[model samples]
Target chain A: MTLALPAAEAARELVEPVLREAVARLDPLTARVARYHFGWADSDDRPCAGGGKALRPTLAVLSGRAAGADVERCLPAAAAVELVHAFSLLHDDVMDDDPVRRHRPAAWTVFGRSHALLCGNALLTLAGELLLEQETPGCAAAARALNEAALSLMAGQALDLEFQGRDDVTREECLRMSRCKTASLLACACSIGVTAAGGPASLAGSLAAFGAEAGLAFQLADDLLGIWGSTEATGKPVLADLRTRKKSLPVVAALTGPTAAGRRLAELLARPEPLAESDLHDAARLVEEAGGRAWAEAETGRRLDAATRHLDEADLPADVRAEFLHLARFIATRDH
Target chain B: MTLALPAAEAARELVEPVLREAVARLDPLTARVARYHFGWADSDDRPCAGGGKALRPTLAVLSGRAAGADVERCLPAAAAVELVHAFSLLHDDVMDDDPVRRHRPAAWTVFGRSHALLCGNALLTLAGELLLEQETPGCAAAARALNEAALSLMAGQALDLEFQGRDDVTREECLRMSRCKTASLLACACSIGVTAAGGPASLAGSLAAFGAEAGLAFQLADDLLGIWGSTEATGKPVLADLRTRKKSLPVVAALTGPTAAGRRLAELLARPEPLAESDLHDAARLVEEAGGRAWAEAETGRRLDAATRHLDEADLPADVRAEFLHLARFIATRDH
Candidate 1:
């Protein structure tokens, strides 16, 4: 997933060192947990470059720059957002019983489950402490954003948990849960970025809309890949969500409608045992046949359209606007 | 435990309502977590008093009064400490896997462990948010204290988990863990009370020292009960720590001595099998025969002495001094 320049390149220069130092600051045990989970360190705490994609921090820094601020000044804020995102992923992996993350064993798999929990909690406190270091409007906005985002993260998590195994879940419910589960935190991340930069008044509103829509698009893309992408590309078994009984947007949309494939899905859901290896292909066929694939693609395109509209409304310098537009388009269309 | 208040209580008429209101202002879910943990709400979120001894909050209020501040002024600080304590208890229950809390099923046992985790995290945030409502000198001190205590708590927790299976762990290691796990937070709580009171310049040192010793006393008493208390009194099975191979102070001291009883205990440790219920009696007998219990009692007394010395050094008013002294005596000597 190569991103468009100016925004992405400038963000890379600002975000990498800040993230590196933050991970370095973790005491030995914390560092080990982070390094292993982020693929940066091995089980023995030795450092490696097995780091993450850092998409969230990139968005933060790029948004800061696009708002006409020196993106470097917002490194702490960007690091904080990334830390929070990583922490959420750590916990989400546990909550979702996801064994593979980025093609490696999840943090809870490497460290003991409770150890992962403590690491997540520590990261959260560290995030708060980091925010306390920021000056004026930044500190104030960060505190608000961190707490609000945490609350929304919990709500999103709860909604996801609530959706598990429920075959009759509605598309609107899936979309709403997606907004809370995925979009709110992303939107808050962008808002905090702009807030740290003392962003232009006109840009905040549009940037926020763009972030929310971007988040929705991202989730839609992810759900689509869960069913349709090849394991080589996504590093996940196709129809993984269906196997886990995850009520993703596509699956719920299919379950809500009554087509020949939908009836087969209903019959499949009636089974009490785990899906066999052979069941995945059949499940994918039924899901696609019931319009799950098309519905998800349409939703993805719709959300991407709205996100672009918000980027246009952002009133950035022409070059910055072009950069944001390119980046948004890349995120919406990325394969992995 | 019973407390001997000053002959004439301080006029603390105004603070209670504000504290109540601050707590009431919490989100409904947060209030539910707090109220349920406090025994003021049932598992279903119906209203009921949680009924555990609100010992920490009482200490905060009385300490505020003794320092010449109106109790009304210190209620938020008092409530904040209780919230922190509640959060600790919520997490501790999960870590320990203790099935019961306050004569009822632990939060994890009732609400499920994940929800318990979320509840604990929420209360920690509430602790910070509640403190922010009143910007007394206590605010920064309390924030710093809570942050430090939380960090120390995690350290102690890490050490405790690390020491879980080993019987040869040193007494010094146990003491260090105890200080981090129990003493620091207690001292922080007491110091925050004094800070909340806007007390005389000379009083802070004594309050801190007093708090630290009192905390050690609290842990000592706790260790004693782990070995000797009845199941009904402790709300835990008899010799629970012994069965778990906890490297508590008594067990640590005995293992080091290698006395006859210690040797026998060490032999049992090598077995690495489930301890029979009958073994608890023998474990306690061996621990006593190794003189571990006697040493623990002496250490408890030493800490009580330190606390009393600090209390006397403060040169508090006769009535205030009497109340604190009585409380300390009760703490160091309590049977349950």
Candidate 2:
């Protein structure tokens, strides 16, 4: 993956130091939890190699570059976006009761839940602090963008939680939730990076549209992996979403379809008891037979095409365009 | 309380509308939870009278007034402070597993922990949004102050959680935690109010000092109530602190004291089983016999005096001085 997009490594290098400095501002315990959650260290605070792909930060850096800004000027915006992302992940893991993240135990699993909650609060506060620390012309605008995205992300998560109790979640509702939960912050990262670099608002708009589509497609790929990807590749249990009956894109598509397999999948999901391994396997098969997997695949390609179209509209230099296309493609097709 | 300090009512009137408007921006489910948490609605979404004293928002309004800013100009700052307070209470109740707040069931108890958590996230985000929406010169400074207070508050909360497992908590460490958890936000409320109104930094500084002292005094009063106040008055279970083995100011003071009663109190708190009702009663008596109650009372008075001294140094109008002093005294001496 690093070989496929060397820019990811560069973005990590540019943003990780800033993230470390910001997280260090936290109280000792919270900072320790944050460091471990970011995969910079193990639960015992030993150094480790378990970090995410830094995809959002890469998008932020790329957006700044497309706007002809130096990487230094983009540092705060990039780090702020990643901090918000981390904050959401920490809270989401707790809310969802998931035990894994970035191929490692979730922060809440290692630390206590309350400590993880405080760490999430600290990270969100740090994100605002980072934007405010920058004395650039675009600092306030960047802060506004980040706040808007955070609010939208929370709203999306709320809807996702609401879906857990109901068996009638529609495909449109699922997409809206995904847009709020996943796409808003990605769009904010792109727009805020350009804004932080004092880029033109028009360029930021195009990049934002590009990011929204790419983010949705990225979520579709994630949903696919949740149901069928190898545990080794995804670093999560196989068919985890099926076992939990998560209302992900593919699951919603399958449940809402008019096929007999779709009806059977819905009935399986509505059961009171936890799904067994066999039941989960059967449910996954039903979802595929009902065309959920194929629909999600098609939707991913369509969204990717739309994202590339927006990038084309930006009239970027060839290298910048190539980098964005490669990144968008990766987001739409990654196993993890 | 309202008759004794009309400013409290005035502040509520000024800030509640702004808070409502901000909360209305959240997703429907979150907005409902927030409305209930704010005491603007019940669990069933009906109107309710249950609410806190709005002390933090009142402090903000009074600080703005002392700086010659109109009540209108102070709305954002006042509401932002209250929102942060609400955010903290929601998260704290969840973390502490408290069953009640403001003479009503805690939001987490009524609506589930995840919903309450998301509502806290929403409120915190709304606070930042309120500050940013203000286009005044002092808006950035106000946001910075709020973020700093929030960070300090989380640090304080982290330490408090850390203290739960350790039997060796020092008085100094406990005081530091109280300053971070309680006083920092109060000071921020004062300073941010002035900053939002474009007041002099010197005035903000004096008001912040006053608020910090008063806030500590307020915590002492709360700790006293946690042990002795009637459930009807305090809106919490009597002897709640002892039952939970909470390391509140009084308990810490008692545990660190040199008396035999203090040593006995430590032994009781260290036992693994849940403290029975009789054990809680015994622990309360031990804390008092160890002079914890007396010390907390004297310290509250001293802090109140220090608060008034800072207010005197500010050279406010006679009416403003009287208002601040009345509020400070009320805070130090309140039974609930």
Best of the candidates, DockQ:
2
Tens-place lDDT digits, model 1, residues B82-155: 66677778877887788888778887887667667766776666666666545444554555456566666766
After TM-score superposition, the amount by which residue B270's alpha carbon in candidate 2 deviates from its true location, in angstroms, is 2.4
- What clash pairs does model 1 have? A39-A50, B15-B72, B38-B50, B39-B49, B39-B50, B40-B48, B40-B50
TM-score quality measure for candidate 2: 0.97
lDDT of 2 at B9: 83
| Candidate 1: tens digits of C-alpha lDDT, residues A207-235 | 87888998998888888777776676566
Tell me how many clashing residue pairs each candidate has.
7, 0
Chain B of candidate 1 achieves a TM-score of 0.90
- On TM-score, the candidate that comes out on top is 2
* lDDT for position A129 in model 2: 89
Q: Is the docking of candidate 1 incorrect, acceptable, medium or high quality?
A: acceptable
In candidate 2, position A111 carries an lDDT of 98
Q: Flag regions of model 1 displaced more than 4 Å.
A: A1-27, A66-72, A135-137, A197-206, A258-260, A309-320, B1-35, B59-77, B132-141, B193-209, B308-329
lDDT of 2 by residue, A6-109 (tens): 89989998899999999888899999999999999999999888677788888888888888888888888899999999999999999999998877789999
Q: What is each candidate's DockQ, to 2 decimals?
A: 0.32, 0.85
Cα deviation of A33, candidate 1, in Å: 1.2
